[model samples]
Target: MSYFLSKLVRFNRSSVVGAVGIVSVGSTLLFSDDDTRFRTFVTARLPLPSQDASLLTLAVPNDLFPPHLPSFGQHGILSLSSYRVGPGSSSDISKEASGAVHDGSKPCGCFGRDTIANAAAKVGPAVVNISIPQDFYGVTTGRSIGSGTIIDKDGTILTCAHVVVDFHGSRSSSKGKIEVTLQDGRTFEGKVVNADMHSDIAVVKINSETPLPDAKLGNSSRLRPGDWVIAMGCPLSLQNTVTAGIVSCVDRKSSDLGFSGLPREYLQTDCAINVGNSGGPLVNMDGEIVGVNIMKVLSADGLGFSVPINSVCKIIEHFKKSGRVIRPWLGLRMLDLNEMIIAQLKKKDASFPNVSKGILVPMVTPGSPGDRAGFCPGDVVIQFDGKPVESMKEI
Candidate 1:
């Protein structure tokens, strides 16, 4: 009787373990559903009515990977490989703050809706990715990235002058060859028809069968602080990437490219401007381009600037006419008039004022306007053409 009782206890333990395994398996199957069934359930329960269901469905791609599908954490599953599409697989789809589709067909009737999507969709086709053939340490290779539009059709492309011009090589000659890649992935050899390093603007031409979508030029001179602005470019080679920020300030003068001498008018925006985004368009509402993204302050956050398009137009005109640009020169050597310099100048000339003000002329061009205007080595220029000459920058 004791042997029989011990055997019965062991049999009961085995049965309990087998029952637990079956129950766990059943629970998993019941909770998880396949792509098709899940979609049906979601569609049925979706907050939208049957009539508006089409719009919600349109937001989702037809092919989306089902939930619970295993994904490796590193190096995302590449696009075409086992990237099963059934429920959520639209690479182009992203959320807009106002829930408005960037479709022109839809009425963006409300004012508060984020117009970024609409703006991006409007200008995206015009922005082209630029690639240049580079020879790094004697190895010929190709480097590709982003730049964008001022003109839509007739193959006229606007980008940062530095993008096409190779500054490393002979500064007198064309820097590097440029290739413009459109949104459709077609590439063409782009020639630097015009460029101005001073203003940092360049125009390239391509022959396309279809009429290109040209960007509508807006008046950057009219741009004010707190105005709505958008920057669209390939940040890190990611094409048609749209970032939204306001015009942090306009007409910000910083000696970013001091080598170019003096500063030009700049539109300061908080938009994330990356290296590849150079030569891309900074647009405003109504889909008009106000500025061209140029450089960003490295040490500070949210500090990015663009060359005003108005300043670029004259340069572009010069490129169209001359095939090169001739930058205007004031032709004078200037130094900041500070206290140390003021004391030294006062010691030399007792007639000079004690207050540190105005730009001190160290040397003036003999044949240039400065010399003609009686400006000498010791002369303190309080004003230049009626503009206050404060520092070397102002001078």
Candidate 2:
């Protein structure tokens, strides 16, 4: 609920700069001085607060030059100091008395504390914890915990495809049993209706005796970077956990990140999400579902990914009608041009041209549309439908 600014220091050698100020977010620092031969030294340590009050004081050395050299400027040495006075301190009390503090706890006529609390109260009931039982050879192997959002009054739940899929990377059939737990401690048997691996989305249905609470779907296209978002899920088997963060990016390509089995674009956020958080809902400030938590980068922190609600809506409609996604197939086997492939190509034939980027077609199906369109083996597909194609996945 409380946010604090973290300081970061960067060093540059190309320019001679002497100043002290708060660095802006994502700002670049450059130094350039052609006349002076300067050797800069930088040392940084974590700030320590005072015991009585959270007051951070940083002292920088004034004498930066060696004893052999004379002072260059009006001051022989420069000393820079900074202080960070914490909340509730004397400085903050003065600001509060002056009405400079913005009270986030009060309603600001918009998405304030009251609105966020009301949104959570309205949507929390619809977020359910999903437990999937993996059965192999008639015996129970193991189980996986995830999260889902009820999308229909009749108990239709929407979750990630990976949640319903078995450990062996196979979709769960109707016979497979899944347990859905509501916030009220009620449990129901769920059946997988349809799942799409490419889009990483699945729909489950549970025949509830009474009507269930459903979440309102929102437009993901309206989401911009820095927009506030709340993620609700059962992370690490903790039920009904909620975390808040900002939208990190709107359109992150899965292929660009070396991630397969994902749609072309995905939503990225900094929300604290964990393993069991998959298939949960990423709600906007208005309490509308904007995305579905899918995956997080294991090697990085706070790099959570989600499937946009708009894309999921399209997939849900398609699955509802056809029970499966029908994808257009291009009968062509191609490889992305890279350094290794270029090296191999040059070794195979000295006449091979040095191409930086393109999809190299190793073979084209004989009777397919590609062959009919005069495509042949060893042909490079630089573009598709007028868009540049760098990878076969893009095509």
Candidate 3:
């Protein structure tokens, strides 16, 4: 909110009434060197200086490439098939526009308007009920029920490790037998291949008679705010329950919620997720799984969190390679560096280490991993694994 004074015109013979050319952008006032000119701009923006000094107007750029196609038409990404039944066969008018057809009738299979329905169909069958029978002191106790997603046709399930792990028992979830019930009412005995407690991701394998329905994995990095997504799970043990909502956020920090020992970040959505919805697939409109439903705020409504499918994929890769997720942590507190933060840091000490980019390492715990790794307090970490890092959140 500032204004810049450009040219000042003195009145006839140093008169008090002077016409001052003031440039204003917001409510801020800009004055001349002698404090004579002052102006406050509200809604209007000051026009930029023209090449001709005599002119006080603005120049409009010509549209070098104006659009020639119609605004509303068949999009190339979701265009209908043009193939006909035969050479002399009449064109089917009913299925021409895929956006018009409804249920029970011949499905148009439109990707435009019916994305929600299509996503539900693809993800519903892949979502399965994961039951972990808890054993205490060699006795059969109650079982914990959660959800899982079939990520592979050969009965490979993607779920949260917490789902199969009993909170009371010190034993691993893989030691116990897990029962996976598909949406089609087929029950299969699942064996936990590996469970990464750091990321809350688990991989389960089952022997199936035939190929099972699986969900496609989407790029969670492409997800943005307001993107339509469907949460498919068996919430409260209710079968095939689907909730529709928009992606409220993509990278929500787990530390901000005071949640310890969880993945650093999570995908936040407004979709309804209950106790039994954990490990369910958060499906996108393209019938692809973008995230895994993990937790929901009990006190508030519409607050749900999920693990990004991309991160889960990474954990699974680690499981396949090392059979465990290796999370190396450096006990150093850092801040995202910016111009304002640099100025603030310089105020405290003149030699605050001049850094224009990267995260600001403010404190390093003594005898911690960071200290043993030769990390200093005032050092700035510009890259990780040879890749440039700009913010702490992104790192």
RMSD of 1: 29.8
lDDT of 2 by residue, 202-257 (tens): 88888888999898998898787877787887765567677778899999875455
Q: In TM-score terms, which candidate is top?
A: 2
How does candidate 1 fare on TM-score?
0.63
Candidate 1 on 251-339: residue-level lDDT in tens?
Answer: 77544322213445688898866546777899876567888887664434566778888887877676556555454444455555667
| Candidate that beats the other on lDDT, 1 or 3, i.e. the better one | 3
Query: Candidate 2's C-alpha lDDT?
Result: 0.60
Q: Is candidate 1 or candidate 2 better by lDDT?
A: 2
Instruction: Name the top lDDT candidate.
Output: 2
In the range 79-194, model 3's lDDT, one tens digit per residue, is 21111111111122223222322324454456465456555765677789887665567676556778899999999999876676433212233346778898778898987776
Where does model 1 exceed 4 Å of error? 1-109, 112-114, 141-144, 150-152, 168-176, 255-260, 321-328, 344-356, 382-395
Predict model 1's lDDT versus the native: 0.55
lDDT over C-alpha atoms for residue 121 of model 1: 62
Give the Cα-based TM-score of candidate 2 against the true structure.
0.66
TM-score of each: 0.63, 0.66, 0.57
Ranking by lDDT: 2, 3, 1
Please give the range of 10 consecutive residues that has the lowest summed lDDT in model 2: 1-10
